[model samples]
Target: DFRPHDEHYVQNFVLVTHGLLMRIFCMCYFRWTVLEFDQVWNPQNCEIWVLEKTKKGRYRLAGSWQEESKSFGPIKFGADKTKLLYPHMKESTPARDMVPGKPGWLDDPALRHLVVAAQFGKGIGVNKELGSLG
Candidate 1:
């Protein structure tokens, strides 16, 4: 059983496979327009949370999963709203990529590898989660 974001509107993802296995991931993006310009910036990130199933058949957040790499750097959830400390965030956060355009998960080699491994282990199809996100 898979719960789509639109249907739940909770800005969360619940993926259940092979009956007993359940994985929860959270992805969110938002944009804001400033002044009279039509231009807007969208930042997005995916959060893989540790979900524990309750006796009542409900899921609860335990914590989040973080991956750190000395070769590359610490994996990020993407440019968050806090990055908007200035009117021109593009200049301030040149290192961070905006979401809906650059998915950090797909861009980072380590993150990509983790996703692929999870998919393979769970017997999930290719880009199934990506399609849902997009």
Candidate 2:
């Protein structure tokens, strides 16, 4: 089952995605601002720990997904949160015609197809029984 998405989580993911796209892929020419002003994330339950697989397909801590290739996580918060980083992120070619921008952008139906791409792979686990700082 899918985790119930918190809007806070979704919004911040957009911020990270946009930032990554800008610095790495140059898909956008805009600044870090979500719309007009920047969206300052809250540093509570939003801490993100990136988990990656090795070349041999073994699970390993990737240190950080790296917000625009900058060092700041394994567990990130506030301006660094990024739990949803997934496949093709570095290679995500934003459709020139369908980048996010609308009254209710998160609820946009056209981009719904991107949801699976953002989901954590089946390898990710939670709790001590699985793997977590807790």
Candidate 3:
């Protein structure tokens, strides 16, 4: 069963997905921003982590997620603080055509093919109980 807070987790996952997309496949012009939200029931329970892709083709945690209860920063989580980083668009493409924008092609099922094509196989990390799964 999904908890009441599951929706927040799902939204976080969507943000992570967009971040991965911008980092790997999208052109360098695109910028990504992730803003986490705390559950209303618990003010101190929320977090926002922002990952930015540098010019050198590497992802970096742009800033700390932890902040005072109502502190302001590049990324904020609230009803009024929803302006994440603006995504980049190609020279010929209009700003409205960018991914995650209103009515963009990223929602198409055909994009699933692109995602599968870009996926790397699972890694061979050591398992605590089963030991090496490789």
Per-model TM-score on C-alpha atoms: 0.19, 0.21, 0.20
lDDT scores in order: 0.30, 0.32, 0.32
Q: Is candidate 1 or candidate 3 better by lDDT?
A: 3
Task: Assess the local accuracy of residue 61 in candidate 3 as a C-alpha lDDT between 0 and 100.
Answer: 43
**Per-residue lDDT for 2-117 in model 2, tens only?**
23484443311223444333233221321122211121223333334343435553334343445576664532312235543222222223353433433333343433323332
Which pairs of residues collide in model 3?
Answer: 36-48, 38-46
The alpha-carbon lDDT assigned to residue 35 of candidate 1 equals 17
lDDT of 3 by residue, 1-134 (tens): 44557764332232433433433333333322121112011113234545554566445444325557543344432344443322121121223322532343344432322222212223322222332223
Q: What TM value does model 3 have?
A: 0.20
Over 40-72, each residue of candidate 1 has an lDDT whose tens digit, in order, gives 122124434344555654544343355452122
Ranking by lDDT: 3, 2, 1
Off by over 4 Å in 2: 1-82, 92-94, 99-110, 113-134
Model 1 weakest 10-residue run by lDDT: 28-37
Better of 1 and 2 by lDDT: 2
